[model samples]
Target: MLAHVTVTGRVQGVGFRYSAQQQAAQHNLTGWVQNKADGSVELKVEGPEQKVDRFLEEMKAGFTQFIKVKQIDVDRFNKDEGYKQFSIK
Candidate 1:
């Protein structure tokens, strides 16, 4: 499955992307996370269904702490499904 998470907030820096990479790696997920020009971080994670759930949980885990997740738009497993490993794109 593929899960695309677009998080908005003060998520550009403060180790958000790195932490996301860590979380994704921990779940053995794949895809990427990148700092958007609009001061948000967009992440794409692909893995097993259970792992994807955990991935989302892990993603929201740091919200309002390391970063404020004002908004989240998730597109769940609608398309691609072949990501080797997570990355910062």
Candidate 2:
């Protein structure tokens, strides 16, 4: 499973990408996270259904002190990008 996620709020320059990368690693997920020009954080993660869901849950729950997750828009699909590891892009 793959999830294309957009996180909005106090996300930019607040260690969101790195935090997300760590979380993804914890979930054994593979993909990438990047900061968008629109002040949002965009992430693509691929893994098992349960792990992906857990990763999303952690995202919504605010994994770090600096990250205040106000909203999350996720589009889930059955596509694989063959990512070898989670990273910050």
Candidate 3:
């Protein structure tokens, strides 16, 4: 399974991407995370359903002090992006 996630509000320049990468690695997920031009963080993750859900939960709850996720956009992704490991992009 693949999921595209967009996180908004105070998400950049606060180690969110790095923390997300670590969480993804812990979940054994493969994908990428990047900062958007609109001051948001975008993530593309591919893995088992349970792992992906766990990753998302971690992102939501783990960085509560630095990140205020005012909006989250999640969608089913359908593409063979050939990601080997989670990374900050």
Best by lDDT: 2
Cα lDDT tens digits, model 2, 12-65, are: 988888889999988899999999999999999999999999999999988888
TM-score, cand. 2 = 0.96
lDDT for position 36 in model 2: 91
What lDDT is obtained when candidate 3 is compared to the true structure?
0.85
| Deviation (Å) of 52 in candidate 3 | 0.2
In model 2, pairs of residues that clash are none
What are the per-model C-alpha RMSD values against the true structure?
A: 1.8, 0.7, 1.6
Deviation from native of the Cα of residue 79 in model 1, angstroms? 4.4
lDDT of 3 at 63: 60
Give the Cα lDDT of each candidate. Answer: 0.80, 0.93, 0.85
Count of backbone collisions within predicted model 3: 0
Stretches of candidate 1 above 4 Å error? none
Better of 2 and 3 by lDDT: 2
lDDT (tens digit, per residue) of candidate 1 on 1-89: 88878998778868898888888888788899999888888888888888888878766767337676667789886566677778888
TM-score (C-alpha, index-matched) for candidate 1: 0.87
**What local lDDT score does residue 28 receive in model 3, on the 0 to 100 scale?**
91
Per-candidate TM equals: 0.87, 0.96, 0.89
